[model samples]
Target: MPVPSPYALLLSNVMVREASVSVLDSSTSYWDYGPPNADTVVVAVHGFRGEHHGLDPVVAHLSGIRVISPDLPGFGESEPLRDLTHDIAGYTAWLRAFIEALGLHAPVILGHSFGSIVVSAAVAGGVEASKVILVNPIAAPALSGPNGFLSRLTLLYYRAGRALPPKLGGALLSNWLIVRFMSLLLAQSPDRDLRRWVHDQHHTYFSRYATRDSVVEGFEASISADVSQFAPSITAPTLLIGADRDPITTVDAQRRLVELFPDARLEIIPAVGHLIHYEKPREAASAIVEFLGDGAVAVSEAAA
Candidate 1:
């Protein structure tokens, strides 16, 4: 059963379609939103354990820009790369290849959470982008901040999942109880309805991976590196929308991250956490619009 998106009304008029492209020997599934000929085209990368649907709320707010949100290799509908582990290096290479396949000249790029690390690495490694936006960016290493203890537990959880037999491991990793618990950890919103929806989204899509090994490998990439590692190498102007209450990356850490980039600014949103795309999409869209200028103005108007 598909849970209805609360933002459906807002996106009722938006043109959206499923699009696919061959990149690195995988047929990538992506959602193409807004005007095809729009001047502002954002290649939005979603976080770990998420598909293109995870970023749909933010897409709903951005009325004018063409946002191409893809299911990273091995996650959602996308297949795993033919001969690469789903680590930072593999994902980074795939992103660079994916963008090149699109043939868009220096399109604006955006990433959320784990996607932040991948995008940062891609830009640092020579994928061109006119501007960059990170939502709830994983600014610091997962094991080095206020949430270190939680991250450790998450590591152990993954380790246990990988240790089990393939069938058992996949079942354990995708268990509804565990998925809901993770959703509870990240959903800091006071609104009960919002929190429930966030949980619903996680429960529905969090475990839709190509394989257990790929998922664990992706988790390793997420925790081992962050946006800060590649920040200094990214020369383009960047916008980071941080949640003051984010459990995955503290606001203080995000502030520190902003300093690592030569031309980056941070926008802190209150009363939200790691799930900013689901809980505070409008705010995220507004920050992105402001950073993107005239080509992104329609999103500001739509959000307002």
Candidate 2:
């Protein structure tokens, strides 16, 4: 039997609820998990070409804290931004508004991959958060070599795809064969079953969640983003988690990020790649729970 799609499995789970919020004149869709009245609210953000469900595994292991994972505009069920650049600054602005609209004050902001960049930008712009957590955070250009080269190549291919008619371009970019091949190349887990599942999840989401314009814009934004410059402005206590085997964002890069922050620490997960949350959710959740401590508890009663 074939494995179930990630979204299908996610829907079957009871902890997750589909929700939406209006911000910047667009309806932003998201997944809300855990108790609504939780004292700790985690605004979880996914990577490029990713949807809220990508982080479902990690959220499953978390208790007490409510996790709100948004489908960043133009990526999942969320509506694309009108007449705005899909870069770090654009995302940062939207995030600020989204948080305020939801009445989330000093919520714990958790970002992964591209999401990390967004969180960093928001914090740098003075968006208040009690704490910030970056998972598989992308490094500065100076620290990224082979990964940077690959990213440029991807952007070039995306640009070429965009020049074609919408149908042809979309089909070319969303080809299952190409998506599966890329997934195989990116998989770094030693477990065969886990690798297969990750590949399946990537293929399913990449095929539908993104458009050529969004992909191109997001890639361009990432390459040009410089979060280090804004590090000193961030006052929130920060935790950085890096995967030992992640090629895109190395552990060394994560260390460099820690150095830039005023109050930050780093932890490296063993034998995992960039998809640390999916590959080792239990371990990741444990580290996060320990870091958050009593702050993650929903109620004073739960804390005791």
Among these predictions, the greatest lDDT belongs to: 1
Q: What is the C-alpha RMSD of each candidate to the true structure, in Å?
A: 2.0, 4.1
Per-model TM-score, in order, reads 0.95, 0.90
Q: Whole-model Cα lDDT per candidate? A: 0.87, 0.78
- Model 1 clash count equals 0
Deviating ranges (above 4 Å) for candidate 2: 1-14, 142-144, 295-304
Q: Which lDDT value does model 2 have at 117?
A: 84
1-304 per-residue lDDT for model 2 (tens digits):
4555333343344366787998898889988887788778899988878888788778866776788988888887888777677888788988998899888898999988888888989998999999999888876662257666776777777787788899988887888887887787767878777787898788777755456787778767777775566677788998888888887776766778789998988889998888887887766777788888842312123223
Local error of candidate 2 at residue 242 (angstroms) = 0.5
Whole-model lDDT for model 2 versus the true structure?
Answer: 0.78
lDDT of 1 at 141: 77
Give one digit per residue, the lDDT tens place, for model 1 in 219-265: 88899998889999999999999998887788778999999999999
